[model samples]
Target: MTLDFDQICALLPHAYPFVLIDRAVEVVPGQSITALKNVTGTEPFVQGHFPRRALMPGVLMIEAAAQACCLMMLAGHPSPKPLYALGRVERFRFRSPVRPGDQLVVTAKADKVVSTAAIAEVVCRVGEVEVASGRLSFGQVGSA
Candidate 1:
């Protein structure tokens, strides 16, 4: 399954460049999804993140991972809810700098899914190299 910006906004609370993810290229219910994020110089963060060489922040890369998880959650249901309280991140490492125009492939796999929460192992990559990897925890809200 794939989602556009309006659909994404309906699922997640983040807006504009903060939304991080642009779309889901692949999705499997309660299993995994791969989402894409297009980092651009036009993004607001670029203005202050660096004066001339704009690099996407490490935290935003993690946000992209979370967005991929959100898409996976949405793909499973007739209706979906926003994920709340990003519990923790473990073993997160930024291997390379993500620059403007880089296409970030964020992939997430559900390690566990329950009534109240879900846990996933997530990663961000560019081509063949791993850019970031970590475990992400999510709490499901009642509604979007």
Candidate 2:
């Protein structure tokens, strides 16, 4: 099954410009997820990233991965999904530059999950090139 924009909005607390991924192509509850992001020249950041050359910021790739990880973490939860905030990033590597018109395929697989925290292995790729890979950790946003 796939999650469209509206369904993604329902499960996530993000809105336009902030919500990175465009579609959830595959989801396996707490185990893993794969999403897509189609970069465009009209994206807000593109105009300013560079006047002559525009490339996707590495930081945003990581953010996209984190968001995908959160979706993987949330898919298995009961109704009224809990909110999770990125807590840590580890062993991340950027392999290539992402540019507008590229489609980023982000896949996140859960490493560990508990009541308050979860960890995931995430990778983002543009066709045959791996753009970024990392491990991300998340914690429930409102929990104490």
Best by TM-score: 2
Number of the top lDDT candidate: 2
RMSD of 2: 1.7
User: lDDT tens string, model 2, 1-144?
Assistant: 578777777788888889998899999988899999999998888888887799988889988898888778776578667888999999999999999889999999999989878999998999989889999999997621
lDDT of 1 by residue, 1-144 (tens): 777767777777667657877888777877898888888888888898998889998988888898778778766576445456677788899999999878999999999998677999998998888989999998876566
Query: Weakest 10 consecutive residues, lDDT, candidate 1?
Result: 76-85
Where does candidate 2 clash, by residue pair?
A: none
Model 1 stretches astray by more than 4 angstroms? 80-82
Q: TM-score per candidate, in order?
A: 0.90, 0.94
